[model samples]
Target chain A: MEKSLVINPDKCTGCLQCEMACSYENEGVFNPAKSRIKVFTFHQEGRFVPYTCTQCSEAWCQQACPVDAISLNLVTGAKEVNESSCVGCKVCTISCPFGTINYNQSSGKVIKCDLCGGDPKCASACPTQAITYVDADQTGLDKMRQWATQTDNATSNTASNA
Target chain B: MHYIIIGAGPSGVIASENIRKLDQNAQITLIKGHKEPPYSRMAIPYFLEEKITEDGTHIRHKSNSFNEQGITLVNELVSEVKTKDNTLVLSDGSELVYDKLLVSTGAIATSPPIEGINSNHVYNCWTLEDARNIAKKAIPGSSLVLMGAGFIGCIILESLLKRGVNLTVVEMGDRMVPRMMDESAGGLLKSWCESKGVRILTSEQVISISEAKAKPLQVNLKNSDPLSADLVICATGVKSNTGFLESSDIKLDQGILVNEFLQTNIENVYASGDVAQGLDFSDQSWSIQAIQPTAVEHGRIAAINMVENNSCVHHGSINMNILDTMGLISTSFGQWMGVEGGEESVLLDEQNFRYLNLQFKGEHLVGISSLGHTQHIGVVRGLIRGKVKLGVWKERLMNDPTRLMEAYIANI
Candidate 1:
């Protein structure tokens, strides 16, 4: 079965290990600026949200790519940027609704998450288990299970009170 | 069913692909006028900058992509569209019949009418051939005078600089990118480019270009001294390619007119990309948005309507322009000029080359223009495109325009 990277923002500690791992895996650096996965800090609310390419089946970046540089990797189901073909026009960056794809000024090419060719470094590097790779068909399975267990406990508590 | 798509630009290619997806047995023919592989003209700047090779500009990297997809690639120009006959007369004296026809011939660069503008050493950076010619003549330390400071001009500004040319930009407007930027924002862009060693002459016009003994070409100005340069690159503007449809029944305006379904007056004829003037989302007006996103949207919608019989209606496209001049990033979205009687909130930091102007109509955010700030700015586009009601956040934004992210999350 195909696997997908699932993110649980509630479990995130905002240590940026995922960012470092992603940058090193893709760009060979520990710089968050170069990382494809970004953690946005909501300073006022004390919240951190990690965001990256969701690998949309109908990706705007893929469709709007002037040179057709973005293509789907069948094995990983990841939209990969062929750097050799990319002209670095930044059209993909602008076309992406989530702003996940960005221009690499140094290489003169656009960069995005490639799921590390099926073994995502961000998922592997998460210290808090906030990011995990699971079956693509069951991305919401864990959340559903958690809610189901809570409902069962509440129903049992009500029965005992009655 | 046979689908004939003229022009192998983004619109035609995407439409063909989408059609192939929807109809497995449909025969798709993509006619490209140029001899080169289907390539993007927008990638010409990158080609000129030596970031990628000429092959890198091909719309599809694989040589046999169209063939593999069962799409026939025709290398001939359409001379006329016979709407009555449901046929296209190509330049090579050949006629092709089609059940449905899509006109996506795109736009051509237009040079201002001036004497000797076509003289040697003057070129338009429009096509791959133009980029090749520019790359040869734009050697390091070469003197190049670029005319016009519009969107196209500013796009190639950095590429020209990176080539190490002693460059001078002459714009007829009072400041840079006047069509997309306001006076204050445009003025700020001018100063930023000037600081990067570009000689900018605003409110200046090139009267004529003549051959000179001292230089390759002499560019005469309307108000100032003539400038001598090794090359003169014109980036004035572009006009839609609708000459082929002059005699046809296809409606015409500044471009070929299409309705909400991207269909012309003719039932089987459709138009998309820069060639089709359709609906504008911000003001519900009809206009041409010569951008890639709009082209992609139009292609998909038109192709869907072609196969599914008016199954899709184009809601219209937002007017968005993003530019990176030198190292500064600037963007304008929707009705950035602001409607009359609309409220505006502006934040200008000339010292840091940062500026933000938000235009609000009553409780809704309608438009925005920003420079030098890139973090979470996509929310600004989301707000404008979503037409979110700002309510009390309008006053909060007026107090501090930097709170756009907060305003967007709260409202959207």
Candidate 2:
């Protein structure tokens, strides 16, 4: 029962609705800063990339979180942050490579993505299927086809040249 | 399959009704993460100034009307999304499985990285809760320190100044809303703000903030200086809520990237609202502006594409601005600032405060910005969005704005 969000940067228009959904789901308000999932805009490249806690089987934010504020939810396979236990020290914020976990200064708590338990708000709010909650194991299917298209281009280019 | 939509904001509620209209047999359940019904985010500054009440800012007509249409309104949060089994785990431990899913999760305020930003007086006005808290503490003649003098900052200053809030707006940038207006307009706006007693600090970066008990928040400046204020607010910007999304297979970048169809890589998942950055008509790019109109439009477009795919959806291809502050009403659509094609013609009467600036690329109207005039505003928007030629309106645009549209429609 592994659940994960599949993000396609090509389709992403970078609206921040996913971030809004994540924050509203966990924080009881429509706040993007409080959202566990983060969307980063690559302005120079004319692209938008939304990233969140990948909820890796080997979670760094979870292990780095002091007082065990972050824990893996078995039902949805999401690493959730317990605000009451979170000290807002931002230890996990530093320890995680992606920097998904953040400290809420107002609430004096640490927040990260919890997969909305399992029905992620980001995936729901996305007007484009840029972000989707899908089978973790089969996430690479799109990439496989994408590369496969690239692979076919070689023969087509060679044929056109001939 | 019963549909449960969460966070009855503009995105969630509109999505519900659109879904119902498309597939009437589908049972819908809408959940609100907050106590109040969905409201417009853009009208907030006006509401705070007593120009309009909370109802005046509502994006939804009759929120409770959803229940009459056989939609369940759940006043709670959806604790989890169990993607493996395809079910929603609510705060009450309730679960809902849907045939399709739409996430209208909006954005949050990103508090700037300043010193002592957690003081009791520091605030960010992105939520009803934040607004209420700031309002409770906002008193006449209360000194205010606002970080990031962007569009929101200027509007907030204009609105709050009328009510006697001693305000000082600090921006890291050299000009205000550099993305929207050109350098000249910014200089004019800077003078306007200063004339209104709104202290403007440009090219000044707030390093950190010290304690604010008896004195104002001691803001350590980029230079070896410090400013003090009783209340400090960070309007720097915001980041998206893609946290729990890590576990899911949703593709994300500045936001969840959906295609023209507004469908995620996954089978039945869709994203919209502030968090979803679609297309930018202004720069022919992809960026998300945390404006309330874009959120509602994104939700509507996404919901339509979700159920039916008859029409194409564009994350706007141009950058646009339409705002009215005090007696000033101005709008600029498309790239009017420094694009090479347009020849600039401005009618500026400082004494009368009747300013109309038009930049023309050949005979068509490329961009327009004005003060004390309300004609050709919608016509410009329609032209920019439609890329229609302004053969008829060009001769009489500077003369009159209201009739400009009629003439253009007839000629074209």
Model 2 spans with C-alpha error above 4 angstroms = A1-162, B61-63, B77-84, B89-94, B282-284, B309-312, B315-318, B338-344, B349-366, B392-407, B410-412
Clashes of each: 0, 99
Give all TM-scores, in the order shown: 0.91, 0.65
Candidate 1 residues B115-170, lDDT tens each?
Answer: 99988899998888888899999989889999999888898988899999999999
Model 2 per-residue lDDT tens digits across residues B170-248: 8888987666666666666677778767888988888888874566678778854677777777888877655646666
The positional error of residue B262 in candidate 2, measured at the CA in angstroms, is 1.5
Query: Per-model C-alpha lDDT, please?
Result: 0.83, 0.63
- Candidate 2, residues A1-162, lDDT tens digits: the string is 576889887898988998888777877889876776666564446867676666654354554332334676888877787664454434454333244565565664566677777888899999999999888777854432232222211111111100
- Tally clashing residue pairs in candidate 2: 99
Residue B9, model 2, lDDT:
70
User: Which portions of model 1 show Cα errors greater than 4 Å?
Assistant: A140-162, B375-377, B389-400, B403-412
DockQ-based CAPRI category assigned to the predicted complex of candidate 2 = incorrect
